[model samples]
Target: MAENVVIEINNLAKYFPITSGLFFKKKVAEVKAVDGVSFAIHRGETLGLVGESGCGKTTVGKCVLQLYRATSGEVIFEGKNLCDLNENQLRPLRRKLQVVFQDPYDSLNPRFTAADIIGEPLQINSDIRGSDFDRRIAELLDIVGLAPYMADRYPHEFSGGQRQRLGVARALALQPEFIVCDEPLSALDVSIQAQIINLLDDLQDKFGIAYLFISHDLSVVRHMSDRVGVMYLGKMMELSERDEIYKSPLHPYTQALLSAVPIPDPAVEEKRKVIVLKGEVPSPINPPSGCVFHPRCPKAFDDCSKLIPQLKDAGSGHEVACLLYKTSWP
Candidate 1:
């Protein structure tokens, strides 16, 4: 592990196997949801993951949280490989890693009151209980900008934004050092999204927690992340510093993705030429032979279909898995 690195992943891969015959199932084909995707989340820094739907961005977050076991490779957190740890070993470490899932309504338990939902983690993981737990729950609600009075309300009683605040409150209850904020803003109103974003920023500043913020919204990712990683069909197309990724995208897929986001200013938006790809994203079960984005790439050549491009340092820590950046294609 390097200095200030909270978590490091190397060639992480996850496959969901398809089966036939209900009684005696036989393996058919597997969905390569996440294949050879690697990146690091530093202490107190957010690493934004952006891609089209079914591009394995969410799977990456789940795998890091150990919600979904990786089929291969390593997930090193705080110098220990999480992939090697079994359920018993992972139970204790679970306190240090938490998740704020997409769809606040779907993630929360509708039957449980806000207090129950937030206090559940503490009851399971810590000794704080009764009045101490109550006090902690109140503090958590305050941390996420929720009133203590609202703790008695059910998930259905609160607004979408308030429910999301409840989810955040629960995640913070354990005081985890790292969080997997999976599309935390996608389900909320635009104005509400701003509130949640600011709350996350304030939480990070106060607690020095790292985040793996996953979403399809490029603008939100740009605002929250220190560095961004682009994935396409389970492969990381590009990874670079936030500003560099936006100003100068190296991968063709990355360029196309960024171009699609509308600029705020009409003058710039009118002048900008959006790079539209030709075909739909390929299925993960049967991906392309080589570069996953080759079928839709504007700059793809014959070699792109023949060789798998490894992510290499283009310059200034900008890693791109595009053959265009290589000297000699073999």
Candidate 2:
């Protein structure tokens, strides 16, 4: 791992066992949620993971945070392999590694006030209590652009955007070095989404926090990410710098995904080609043989159905897992 890299996930895989039968509970199949996914998040940099729903984007985040223990592979954070750590050992490290879930309304406790929600982490991790804790909670509320007086109100009282702000405040309560923002803006209105995005940007700049931003919104991902990774059927199809991936996507899946993003200019939009993929995504329980994307890939050949293309560099920090780019690989 490089000194600048905050987290390195190498061949990270999470599989859920699918069982059948009532008495015996026989293992019938396994859902390969995240399989052989590899990437690194640099210090203070945002790495966007974009894919269609059920592509295992959220599963990757959960695996990194150890919410779901990975079936295999390593999640190395700050020179330490998190997979080896027990729950007791991992608990201490949780403060430095936080997460902001997609649904703010569902994630936050309705029974607790804003102050209680934000202060709960502080209470668990540290000895700060009484007026000190109150002051800290107040400061956090202010930091997230909420009034300090709003601390007394419950999560139900706040609007969708405000609830998200509170969630960000709680994540920031521990001053984490890395945060997994799992589609944080997906639930909010279009206008409110921008505000939350800007808020996250500002917070990242101020705190120098690294983010593994997972989303299906290509436009939003392109806007916030320093680097982007494209996933399909539990495999990473492409990875590259923000501009490189958007400008020249190497993989067929990546190209198709980028093509779907609506252009701002009417004239350009009219002229641009849309690469619509055929058929629905295959079930992860029994993915396609060899290259999982071969079924729908427009450029796939006979080799694609026989061999799984390794993700190799196509120069200039761009990586793609496709036979088309194999000649470029060193």
Candidate 3:
């Protein structure tokens, strides 16, 4: 792991057991949600995770925050392995790691007032109460662009955007260093999504918060991420700097994904080739042999089906996993 790395995920793997049967006999079939993912998030950096649905993007984020217990590997945060930490040991570190879930409405408690919801974490972990808690809640609400008076309202009273703002406020209340933003804008209207993205950017600038922003929206990822990692079938197909990945994608999967992003200009849209991938993503329980992406990869050949490709730097900081860059040997 590199020095000054805020979060390091080494060979992280999270698998959900697929069980079938009635009462006594349950057979186990594993769903490899996140498999052997290794990456590090430097201090105060946003690493955008982009992929299609069920591509293990959310799983990776959840694992980083220790929400899902890793079957194997190390999640090192601030020089401590989160996987090894017991409940008591993880309690203190919880303040430094937080999450803004996908659905804001579902995430917030319907019964509790927004104030209580935001203050819940602080109350649970510390001796704060009464005036101090009230002040902190108010501050957090204001930070996320919510009015101080709106703290008394339930989640139902607020619009979708407002509910998301409350979620952001709750995440901020802990003054966390790293946050897993799991598709934070996916549920919002396009107009509101821009606002939330801007708010996140501003917050990062002001507080230097590191973010693991998981989303399927490539354009949004490009706007928000310093570097981006593309995942497919529980594996990383490509990882590179934001601009580099967008401008010159190396991997076939990455290229196809980028080509699908709608171009604003008519001329550019007309000129760009549409690289539609064939078939569907294979079941995680039974991924294809050699290269998992070979079935859908446009550039895939005989070698792709017989040999697994390693993620290697092609040029600059761009890393790709494909046989295109690999030399044929006798």
Candidate 4:
């Protein structure tokens, strides 16, 4: 796995400044969107990051994509720390690190036709123009399950699923090594969701593209990811192989999250016990001391409120952050 790693993140953290006063605004506090989170994505492997809304799943993706500069920590991609590079230094690497946002329409320009939208990346990054550009556009559309004829149509003219396909095509235009899928299925219908999932799966198989798949949907993550990492309040609760984590979650937070996902079988669903967490998520500006999840964690101990646990491996590459486990990890 070490040799196969395409990207490595070490103690990654992103803190958004919170200020007061409109004109003379000054940094008062910070929203710790990502705090000391660390993980790696292997070549052609999809790493799923799942969490409740505002728990920093998207922030982690942004940090990996270098869309959001980290306050501290390393995001090593292509042998350089992305957070350390300026826009000029990072421009050449942009094509290799593409992203497919949650909202298809919002991420795309309504004024531009589908052809122009997909061709924009090519137009700026590549010297391919005229007939060559046209052929590339058609090829990309076909690759994403869209017809070449639909290239001339506007985003509004296409259905939701088609627009998403269009988004996927644009991401593929650069033939990137890695792609950040930021809740790409959240805005689509359930039926449409499956199509997109399969499309992404097929694309990865064909191109060997690594993906940092961020979503709130547990089932989709389970299906798409080789490994899954569960996050809560800007900290990772657990990380493991998909089957192992789902079958035997070490963290209480992970247990709660998996319990919430409904089983398809009636007999299994009827017998399954749902873990209903208590209280609402605390504010990021004033997060609780020690373990951020202790407030809602059912198995939280007295030390959980005073001692923050670092992610420690609990055998076979499964890592968890909880005071209940007495282990050391570096």
Candidate 5:
């Protein structure tokens, strides 16, 4: 991971309107997919975003890439605010920021050949043409450990892992400085997942690319990320260095989540007490007053239900949003 910052996301929020009626006219509520999330990714580093399903992990990635227009926030990439850029202004910057979606089967076009698929971005963003384009495509396939001959084949002819490799190849065509890996390994088999993860690490080392990796798997996040952020109900609950977050989790929610990860050693697993959460995640449409996790948090008290806990520094750059760590509550 490089020391220079590559992307900055500040107070980002994304909401989807829900309408239900005879005429489908009235806006009943808004799905608060992402709300007031802020983080920064440095060049050549991987920032893992982890949370349960529907916790807005993927939405943060899309909002950063400007794929989904944020309700409010600033996404500054390379010192420029991407939110203010129009379509034409964003076109050039698209090469700098790329995304790899989760579904290999759905993300790729069935009709397009692998060569065409990977070459599309290069063609749009760069002036490389004729033999140069063909050569570059071949090199990309080789870089991704795919045979150059496979380029002529369509997406359907490939297996799930192969299709994902193709997607990676496409994302790499631009030689992007940063990538939003939106659960890219979730669709692959366990064995294939290892291979893809190894490949991503190698590519990062070689190209010096930064990654905003979003996933629900804490173990995977631990392996790949330099820093990790835990989200719940569209709000960040914890943020810290990967090892610190795993080793000494300050928040009760963080401790509960880590306790659930199965230990390979039977003795350790038996000795551990899993802190099972008390309630289901609160609806983001109408989040609970005070801390959103108060309903599920074991350590929550009267003040937790009355005043929202601010994300404050616990120690060593670790931050947590919980009343237990606060001076008043403590």
Candidate 6:
């Protein structure tokens, strides 16, 4: 791993067992939610993960945070392999890693006041209490653009955007080095989405926090990410710098995904070739042989159905997994 890398994932896999029986439930099959995914997040840089629902984007984030124990492979945080650590061993390191879930309404505890919600982490991780804790809560509220007076109110009192901002404040309360933002803006209004995105940018600039921003919105991902990784059927199809991936997508899946992002100009949108992918995503439990994306890929060749392609560098830090680019990668 690089010296500046905050998180490094190597061949990470998470499988959920499917069982069926009358009296004795035997393991029927395993759903390969995340299969052989690898990537690294550097300090202060945002890595955007974009994929359709059930593509295991959320599973990857949870695995990195150790919320879900990986079925195989390593999640290396800083220099330590998180998969090797037990719950007790991981407790101290929890403060360094955090997550902001997709639904702000569901994530925030209604029973607790805003001050208590943000202050809880501080209480658990440190000894700050009394006036110091209150001060810290007020500071966090200010950082997330919420008024200090709102601290005494409950989550129900705030609007959707304000609630999401409160969630951000709580995530930052512990001063984490890395955060997994799991579709943080998907639930908010279009107007509010920009505000949260800008707030995240400002927070990153001030705190030097690295983010694994997971979303299905390509436009938002392109704006916030320094680099982007595209996944399909639990496998990473491509990984490259944001502009590189957007401008010259190497994988068939990536190309199709980017083509679907609506152009701003009416003329440009009409002129552009829309690559509409046919067929539904394959079941993870019984994914197609060889390349998982072969079933729906318009450009898939004979080799795509017979041999699985390994992700390798195509050049200039662009990594792609596809038979077409096999010769380009060494």
lDDT (Cα atoms) of all candidates against the true structure: 0.93, 0.93, 0.89, 0.92, 0.89, 0.94
Best by lDDT: 6
Q: Give the alpha carbon lDDT tens digit for every residue of 1-330 in model 5.
A: 224989988889999998988865899999998888888899899999999998999889989999988999999987788998999999999998999889988999999999999999988899999999999999999988899999999999998888888999999999999999999999889999988898899999999999999999999999999999999989888999999999899888889999999887899888988889987888889988888888888888888878877676887789888888863242
Clashes of each: 0, 0, 0, 0, 0, 0
Candidate 1 stretches greater than 4 Å from native? 327-330
Model 5 worst lDDT window (10 residues) = 321-330
Candidate 3 structure quality by residue, lDDT tens digits, 1-330: 677688999888999987877886675889999888877888789999999999999889888888888999999987899999998999899989999988999999999999989988988877879898888888898899999999899999999999999999889887899999999999999999999999999999999899999999999999999999999998888889998889888888889998988899999999988898999999999989888898998877888788877767777767777778862211
Query: Which digits, one per residue and each the tens of the lDDT, describe model 1 over residues 1-330?
Result: 789999999999999999999899999999999999999989899999999999999999999999999999899987789999999999999999999988989999999999999999999999998899999999999999988999899999999999999999999999999999999999999999999999999999999999999999999999999999999999898999999999999888989998999999999999989888997998999999878788888888898889999998988899999899882233
Off by over 4 Å in 3: 327-330
Query: Which lDDT tens digits does candidate 2 get at residues 1-330?
Result: 888898999999999999999999999899999999999998899999999999999999999999999999999986789999999989888899999989999999999999999999998998889999998998899888999989999999999999999999999998999999999999999999999999999999999999999999999999999999999989998999999999889898999998988999999889889999999999999899878999999988888888888888889789898888764222
Candidate 4 or 3, higher lDDT: 4
CA RMSD per model (angstroms): 1.1, 1.2, 1.8, 1.3, 2.0, 1.3
- Candidates 2 and 3, the one with greater TM-score: 2
Error of 6 at 1 (Å): 2.3
In the predicted model 4, the residue pairs found to clash are none
Native-to-model Cα distance after best TM-score fit, residue 55 in candidate 5, in Å:
0.7
Model 5, position 143: C-alpha lDDT score: 88
Question: lDDT per residue, candidate 6, 1-330, as tens digits?
Answer: 888999999999999999999899999999999999999999999999999999999999999999999999999986799999999999999999999999998999899999989998998899998898889999999999999999999999999999999999999999999999999999999999999999999999999999999999999999999999999999998999999999899999999998988989999899888899999999999999988999999998888888888888999999999989864322
TM-score comparison, 1 vs 5, better candidate: 1
Q: What TM-score do all the candidates reach, one by one?
A: 0.98, 0.98, 0.96, 0.98, 0.96, 0.98
Compared with the true structure, the alpha-carbon lDDT of candidate 4 equals 0.92
Task: By lDDT, rank the candidates, best first.
Answer: 6, 2, 1, 4, 5, 3
